[model samples]
Target: MTRACATLTLFLGLPQGTMGFASSFSACRSQASAAPRTALLRAWGRTSSGSSSERQPLRHLRRRRSEGLVASLSTKGEREGNPATEEEAQLLQHLSSPPKSQRRHQQQPQQPRTSTKRGTTRKRLTSTGGLKSLPIVTPSIELLSHASRRSKKVSQDMLIKNARNRSRKWVAERMDMLGKATSKPLRDIIRQYKHQLPILHPFEATLADLTVRAREKTGERTLQSVLDDVNDFRKVALEISKSAAREGKLGEKKSEIMQTMDAGYSRMEDHFLTNGSVLEDLTEIQKSLRSLPIVQLHLPTVVLVGAPNVGKSSIVRAVSTGTPEVNSYPFTTRGMALGHMFHPETNARYQIMDTPGVLSRPDGERNEMEALTLASMQHLPTAVIFVMDLSGHSGHLSSLDNQMQVRHELRRRFPRRPWLDVVSKADLPRLELEKAKEALPEGYLDLSTLDGTGVEELKTRLFEMYEIIERILAPPPEVQR
Candidate 1:
């Protein structure tokens, strides 16, 4: 009985000697019968509100007692020892350990987490290289009218009480449209022209300036001045639009709002019309710029220059890929003609230009066509092939004396250029040819395009001249230590 009392005390985690053996057995039976499983477990120190150290021994004793009780209950019918009662066995099974679900949850492993953030992409802008890549400029008047039409299409679905808000929105939208039309195009043109003008090849730059000067009227706004005026108008228009919108917001009556907006619109229209000619001038300049040739400055160039009807175009057509008109009149090749040739051995490319005929005259007295030839001589890195008509039989107009004077003037102006003289019409009558040879300067190349005489020789010598030019222009070789 005492041993049974001690065993009951260990299972209940109660103080020793607290009950007599008879009392302890009865107490255990009464407690198991009267209290709930959870209450009994709390008394057994499984979840008791005692200090951890005080509860620890009780917990160990309860675990061992429950194991023994379970073993005894499992062998109740087979063993000879006294067995546990049904209530005590049920309490032990429920309170000795955690629930099955919770134990399973604690035994499982957790998974690692991954990030879900996305990366951002950026856009890149491409650049047009130079003036040759400039797009066509839009006409200012058309742009202005288009903007006005777009602004007029704004929605007018506002309440009557929101007249002031509506007016502000309308005015803001209209001002934005006006700026896009007038200021934006002008700004783009100014930016492109300013950027490209300085980088233009010298000959192209001079030709462009001459073209602009020819179209410009006296006492009027120049291209830059017109651009400035348009920009100023943009600022002024913005200020006027803001003031008008503010006035509309302050207006009490609908008529006052309408009047204010109408007045602002009228002022802007009048300002644009005042500078209508400026827009026209800008349009004309765009046309002229687009008309200019796209000259490649990297290649070697050979330029043909002589008086009109002196077989300059004929020689160009015979020697290069050019096919200029072979007319017997003066200034047949009105503009600069460009062609290409290739070196046989090196596979290098060359530019051949046939310019309009230039007469022997002072700079001030020269025409636009002649000015083009002069611009080439003054600007381009080239070899000059001065064609002469000593036979005077191909309807040539310039006298031999005048042609010689022109040659002397060009040589004096550009003394460093490589020059080659060619006397055309070698197939003329024997008497005229002999007379021409007598009058010709030493080292003249006689050629007849009609029968291809000296054509191949001329091409070879031209390539040799270019070789000399290349040698002069090339960078010096590096020296070894």
Candidate 2:
């Protein structure tokens, strides 16, 4: 009876169904084995009452006995039997929690994280708990791979979108910059200049707007956009130049106008050189820097050829800034003189040479003035500028025979050269002007140089005349616009 009470007291200390195993394990030595078996059968409700699924709780213990998965319980049960068995039996009750490592990690000797990822082999437990190396999930690599794929996909999408946006912006800017009117063709000689100008039309217009108007109404802020667009204007100009030059029509005003710029001369030079076109003609135009003394070949050079004291030097001094040897005598100018005049609009310049005096007399060497003027044109055979005095009626003129001789010599020597005519001293009486006009060549200009009366007008007319003469003398092979 005292033994039964002791066994009952121990049974009270254990968990529910575990009390059956506890009693059986302890009571075999302490009391009745049959009593423990009866208690186990009662705790189970009945020995036959447990279902197959309900009987599954003991399956782990049965399986663990074979696999030795319960080492902690096995060792502890052999040493301090009852309670250790009870604790292990309770441990097997739930799967959510795992047993602590039996080796106690040796406190790991405070191992650094540098320990190998491969775990130390587990030891059989000497205590009531054990650890199994669970599958080590590499959270970092999985996460990194996923994130990398997602980020790469996102980056690719962004790059494509950005490129599309830039293309759209570029198209918008290009269209806006090259408005409508400037894109049209230029027509007429007195009208628009048809040549593609050196300055890019867009940029040139923008710069021009910036200077004249304090603010641009185009609604753009960055100068970079403006500059970017203007660069192409020079390209258009180069195209025109190349086309014109290829056809040998580069000198025609309507054709050459395509290569000029309203911006300035330097701008044209920049646009021309940007595309690497050879500027041989420009070198000839700005010939001041030329090392060799240049001669204009077979060019019509009309000199101020007249008798001294008839105001021949006056005409040279009046039209250009030439300071001739002026005196109130017949033999004042001992030698020939040279001067030049320039006009911007038609792009004309004249090299006027003043002479002594000319006469109708048929001497072998001729008059001092007539001799020098004719001699220069006779050899080079351009044109002659006769500065005849138109102040008196029935003027002392070069005879038809003498005129015929000069024309014959020029036609024989330089057949392709051009000639220009001039009737000087227009401020004279109208009667003398009309009489002088009858005595001169077909397309003659009357000039009074002192007052700049016909100076600029004459320059435009002369330059226009030069164009006609230039076209007639040197027709272009190409029909470039």
Query: Candidate 2, which segments miss by more than 4 Å at Cα?
Result: 1-300, 307-309, 321-333, 343-350, 363-369, 393-417, 430-442, 465-481
Q: TM-scores, in order shown?
A: 0.60, 0.29
lDDT of 1: 0.52
Q: For each candidate, what is the lDDT? A: 0.52, 0.32
lDDT for each residue of candidate 1 in 168-229, tens digit (9 for 90 to 100):
56555654554455566666766665445433333454455555444442333345544444
lDDT of 2 by residue, 1-481 (tens): 2222222222112211111111111000011011232332233222322221211111111111222111121222223323322422322222122235432332221111111114332222111101111111122122222322332221212343555443333322222222221122111210111111111111121112222122112232222221122224323433433332332322234222322211111222233233211112111111211121123432323455544455656666665644643322111235555556564654355455565555544444453335434434432213345444555542335433343344444334333334454555566665444444455567666677655566666555545544533332232232223
Candidate closest to the true structure, highest lDDT: 1
Q: CA lDDT of 441 in candidate 2?
A: 62
Measured over all alpha carbons after superposition, the RMSD of each candidate to the real structure, in angstroms, is 45.4, 54.9
Q: State the TM-score for model 2.
A: 0.29
